[model samples]
Target chain A: MLFSYRIMAIPSKKLAKEDGYTRLKDDFKGYLAGTVFFKNTIIHGYPHIKRIFTLEEGIKRNIKEDGFSVEEKIDGYNVRVAMVGGEVFAFTRAGKIEPYASEKLSFLKEFFKENPGIVVCGEMVGNTPFTPPTDGFDFRFYVFDFMKEKTILPFDEKQKLIKEYNLLQVPFLGKFRKSEEPWKKLREIASFLNKGKSEGMVIKALSGKEAVKYVTPNADIEDIRQNARFVFDMPVGFFNQRVFRSALFLEEFGMDVEEYKKRLGDAFYSSLLEGIKQLKKEGVVREEFRVFVEKEETWNAIYSVLKKSKEIEISDVYKWKEGNRIGVRFSKIYRKTTEKLRRFLSGYAIQD
Target chain B: MLFSYRIMAIPSKKLAKEDGYTRLKDDFKGYLAGTVFFKNTIIHGYPHIKRIFTLEEGIKRNIKEDGFSVEEKIDGYNVRVAMVGGEVFAFTRAGKIEPYASEKLSFLKEFFKENPGIVVCGEMVGNTPFTPPTDGFDFRFYVFDFMKEKTILPFDEKQKLIKEYNLLQVPFLGKFRKSEEPWKKLREIASFLNKGKSEGMVIKALSGKEAVKYVTPNADIEDIRQNARFVFDMPVGFFNQRVFRSALFLEEFGMDVEEYKKRLGDAFYSSLLEGIKQLKKEGVVREEFRVFVEKEETWNAIYSVLKKSKEIEISDVYKWKEGNRIGVRFSKIYRKTTEKLRRFLSGYAIQD
Candidate 1:
């Protein structure tokens, strides 16, 4: 008789006092370190969502025939909200305590107070300092999941509980079966989303954890537009993956390829050209975003935490006192891109 | 007393019996290995030429006021043709013995007979088995340099010798001084080349190796179109470099951005869509090119050598005798790209 043993390389803890994970105590921050001992409980990071370029093939392969809910896949940062010992805390993807969420979302405290020890996972979209503006979503949180202990609650239970708490959530498009030509419906949905300049849709199985996301070509192009100013700072995959997916989306949905191609190309060249103009005229390249906050301390703490993690220089917050809130605008200088563009603009030759 | 001396690391020779280098003995082939020994002499590979995005800054920075000659830069495979022991031999960039050149060009023997041990470096363009077909070239050789021992001969000497041998060379655009608005002239030349659908030009200092090359936007787009089929097999830089250069070319030459944006985007999507269509219909992606040869055995030898170096499967040469010559066609199957595309088409999920 022979036996096989599972051979696994278990990762050891990082050296003590090592820096990387973020922590905050300004409002309600969690104790995030090796093993992330927050309120004497372990909160696992969210699983990475799988993405699909085509709807029919991807849905049939990943989802079941029973039913699936199509929800808007918002373009934003992911954050996990939880109430630990009468305090609300938000954790980022890598178990870092994100203070921005706690300061921005006031309902999180009340929502977590009613549902103790439950983690509300959602996206932080719109006029937040973390990312670019997403139309009308101004520092809003939309609940996408409710995790009890280690497992995510079923769709019905989460919906019931979310409704009871009276919290915001991503808009539910519809429920469809795999046999009902779901791809055709999805193509229509994608077209609508593309027209509105929305991101895409996520297909979630009604009962289980099976889920797959499909994005519109406009979403990919928008991603390129945002990062085009400093494309060199990112890996080539950041742009190529988007372009490749856009092509597949266009082909799969039977959309207008020529129109999308023109827009995609313009998204790349236009943003970068504008960036070049800025650098040539002002000797710098940077991102300027506005954040509206009630308290100046909240913005200051956010700025401090941001500056600690970034290599790029952060500008002092430009505060404009409104009626009751202060609108603060700041910039993150992309110095490397600035220096590189200057060299190229000033006749520095490069080999292709 | 203080003294200083240069320290260098000398590369050791490869162990005997090791494999990687190509060897040929059919006819006029050279002994190629870590050290390229041909006809009782050692021949080194050619150096890479420097490239520039804008002619204005590049010419002023790289080329001095002694005046520079601009020649049409051919988009083709580089080959160093040298006659050794009364045998004409062509070596690729990596010192591989190439028999295709010796078979197609009948005057190589006589040209080498006149100047023994001198390597004439040029490009093989149009209707060839290696690269995509360039218009009007028709498998012709264009001499760009004549090297003696190791150093490249001055422009006047190479031109005189090339003329005496009645060999075809690149069209020599008029020479111009750096201070006499050379950039404006280069823009006109670029526009003309772009209109003709030709690659850009090379500016060579009259007496020195101070040369720089600038390509047209159309050339970059053409490159993308040709390789867009098996783009995954190549580095992402292959596309990004072209796109980046095209943008700079547009900005520097003051071309219409919207027109190029449409074309550039189309170049990437159109060819790839064609490849996808072919793959979905035929289950494979490949490149087919034609080569005109005087003998069947010559085509066979060339095919064999190419197959030995490439991992991609090479198709058997198809021959059709035409009057006094043979027209041969073959294809290289891009199995990796084909397999990857098949997986995506079949709904294999991926994370971006």
Candidate 2:
């Protein structure tokens, strides 16, 4: 019973439509929504799902000969940027439209407006130290896939669209025949990501049918370190989800769930001690994600989006009107009273 | 004849002092001011200059046997975070104090306040694709060197200081023995950086007396691509300085100045063509840098720093005072009409 016959609840359609996604019926085997299963085929709108293989599993199967392409697996949130009804919108993988106007998003909005009917899927990496630091206060998006309407474009066409839009895309390592040594290529890419302070690379078929990510061990450690620093401050559920995601990532590295859970337990306690000591020291912590609306009047739209997204609740919303722009500072803050979730999550850490 | 007898004017003292630096006469050969030259001993304050060596020259000299260590060379602005008179200050390599309060800088300031007379030198990488993208709107600084007073601490002490301060530091590659193949080691490091989206590595002596940078070809291409996107928008002098610096970087890769200048010329013109095409499309270009002063009154201190730094001129200073924080949006904006620099820089592109 590795494959669970139990069907998980179907995902929210509003969320899926917002993100241009429809959840597959496959057993995801992970808490995170976007985790790709091995040999899982891409369904254009919604279709049958298959069991997904981890990068490790994929390498063992020698599937590269099936004609796969390797691209830099960006360490960020999956976002779909599209022109719906001639209006540009960016939706997170979980189907939440980013309610903020970021410089990069704004640029994309304008680009989509000019070129209607175009839809670009990119990884929006920000609000974490997953990748190397880029120049600018705005989050950067690296487009990987392209679509027109509901159909995914060919790889070459996707490249053309990226160039046409003057937008950055995930770095294409190269194409490899399934007969070629893909594990060696994976090692090469992982080493590259390690040196560049990147997470890893994603290998997809030329047809854009299947893709799997190979994350470097260093990135995993870095992710743990990053989360440990603020785990104590996060909401209990948020923290548990983070730990679960980290464990899932470790599973890809061949660490059994039990071993990772133990490691996470130790890391959590240690980080709690360190976090406590560091927290006592007074220092400014800037909220990573903030929306600067050009006009205060436009904030109503943002507010409505926030109201609809129950999963993402803002702790505070600071609105200030500058000459022609309105700066809306909203941070997802967790209250200290929620420390009770720590005990609950601590119990679930190793069990999962 | 290899050494340029044509003296580049002494670096501006006001700029250096403002940045908390004293110019040294040691022949420092590199594109940027802070690039260390091989075996060019540090001079406390300003002193007689010595001849600096290009990477090729340094390699040719077989300086690897001199107990040199290699560390990740971060692509960012050089900053010195120190405590003077029990107050925290951040100085740029040009000897200009950063005129704004940042979470990272403030954290360092408080760190220095707690540990008086400690100086931490780091690279604040931002505003370019040369480095990997960080997780926030703010730029990240990676500490490389630690000092107590004017004396440079040993490598281990530097590590200890970094750990004690709980700060990020550039990753340290392995040490190279003179007997072992240093060139191979250099290539290994270069390849690592190339894979990871980093510019290069800085090789320094175990004694901390000498250092030089080794940049990868990939980083050079990225730097060129990034600058080309915005070169048309910069002041002619600033643009020339950037081009010259890039040419200097090319020297690290053993590309002769003439060859680099020719390559730069081609890239400059091509980028100009593309930039012009993209520029016509009316889109938003947001200022990447902003200062958030915790208190409204702190704005004056930032204003004073800007006033003192002649090289960094501000176009508009927008101050919005919120509940307890003051957000100041100031940037060095060059006029669109200043595109006159295109011709001027295009001439210098191949000439300088």
Candidate 3:
């Protein structure tokens, strides 16, 4: 819970302009500032879910004695989807209206139209700009939580509604008692997911309403490799934690350390080679993001949101029409990373 | 050079106590704060050597067009050895008198007496408490530079003095011009050193007097593996730069990527497993340092110096007699890492 995203208050015009809260003036839905469109209607940001490094220890420490369920923790950006004033809106984990997610969720309009007063806490998975598609698929939303106002609905009711609306939901792993040794099954599931290039599971203590996430080695290793080029751009702990987590996963699950090490090393080599090639050939270090949006306006809206981050510059934007959609490609120029690699490649003596 | 350690000023008693400049009160040689023994007897800290990631561009950018010499870059901690008032003092790179280095250098008494006013800038290599010996030897000093006051003597003079004193000097790799293609030879040298478990070469511009260090892949990789358990205590860049350097080394030297990946992977696996084992068995993360000092006071002096760092806790002291020398073993308990592992192991939900 230390790093949980805090939803912002409805700010004044000046506050919104100053980025105290975000108000995307270019988008009609974001005119009100931040995720707070109306004081009466707000999608509360999801609570931070703690992680478990060791299955047995984590289960003993985090789970309740009984009445606990485990659900598939999808590897995607968290999006809170709901209808506001008859328009469906998808808010990012930070409670800001994400243009890409919001634009793509037009099909969910019917689900909200029928189920009023409820919001769907879902993951925008696949090749979305927000997250690297560890799920390895096209873009789609997978509902993980159904909430009314601030509280999540119980499992049965949420599932019944998902069935009624024919909505995709995270795979329900199952309920278990502490005495049943669920970690055995969970380890198998994590290993299976690791092979499928998917993520891990989240154990929810139903009675206590506390959730904890456990990940597979591939998920952590993939994270490191995916962002290797952005090494200079991100916080230093990003790589360390991933390495630590991979090690923990290997030890706890009784996985073959040699195979995993090769996988990890190969992942590092291939990804880092890309970074080196960029420095050697292009004289820059960055990642290219390709997206297909339903509307040109949608891509523009996403660009506007990204550009406001100030420190990151969106560059090399090119768009091509693919029938009804606009296929666009862009790069988020990590200023610190690009400049750093350029400077180092320039043969400036570095103290190491 | 941006991260170069600044030699501290002679401070007031309060300032000294506040760590403005370290005054190791236990050692007679360290009574003066910082590396400054007296106004006229100070051994200046060596200037930071810049690093080159790419050999070709680095040679073009960092080397002089006319005159430059290449020498073996020793994989050890830098020490400035000088004698003042009949006592030989070995100041570390930051200019603090290293008790262990100073104590071990009694053999250098004659050399200092012979070459008074001229200090030796050398690397304290081998199985010392400082650097993990990539050179793979017992503790020994290899003189790389001879200096009077703050000025490093020219290559010829420094070598002559080293020869006269029968002192070990870093192997000279020969001088070359910009047009003769020195990078080709440097690459071969680096590859050879990589195989021997040594390090790369430092190309010093004789005319410009600027030095840039280029390292072999093994040196960078060894650094990462050696300090894997201390990951939490050190800066995040410690791993990042090493990873970056290894990849660059592969590309620049045209080494086998697949073999390096496996080695790198194995390195991460084995070293990190040690860290995990410590956390699991002892519920803490720490590194053990075993040292053999000729005098018991040397160990006391070293312990006193390390204990003053405040954040680090020296624990589990075990000492025994090895002939005339005292074989002392101690551990530096990394507080942040220990507490973090304990908390994570306790199964408290972590949002990360």
Give the interface-residue alpha carbon RMSD of model 1.
1.7
lDDT of 1 by residue, A241-336 (tens): 777778777777678898987997798789777777778678888888777778888777678767875446677568899788877788877867
Flag regions of model 1 displaced more than 4 Å.
A1-39, A134-137, A179-181, A309-311, B1-39, B134-137, B179-181, B309-311
* Between candidates 2 and 3, the DockQ winner: 3
Chain B TM-score list for all models: 0.87, 0.63, 0.85
Q: Distance from true position, residue A201, model 2, in Å? A: 50
In terms of docking quality, model 2 is: incorrect
Interface RMSD of each: 1.7, 27.8, 1.7
Ranking by TM-score: 1, 3, 2
Instruction: Give the better candidate number (2 or 3) by TM-score.
Output: 3
Off by over 4 Å in 2: A1-352, B1-57, B60-65, B101-103, B109-115, B126-137, B229-288, B291-293, B297-331, B335-352
TM-score winner between candidates 1 and 2: 1
Rank all candidate structures by their DockQ, best first, as comma-separated numbers. Answer: 3, 1, 2
Return the TM-score for candidate 3, rounded to 2 decimals.
0.87
Put down candidate 2 lDDT per residue, A1-352, tens digits, no spaces: 2211123444443113333334333334333343211112122231111212234454434333377777877777666666544455565554344544233466677777666656568776643212333446546678888755445566677777788878888888887775664666665565567568576776666776555555554455456545544543534434322332243344334434343433433443344334333333422121234554565545766566655644434546777776666655665433331232232222211110
Task: Output candidate 1 Cα RMSD.
Answer: 6.6
Best by DockQ: 3
Q: Chain B of candidate 2 versus the native chain B: what TM-score?
A: 0.63
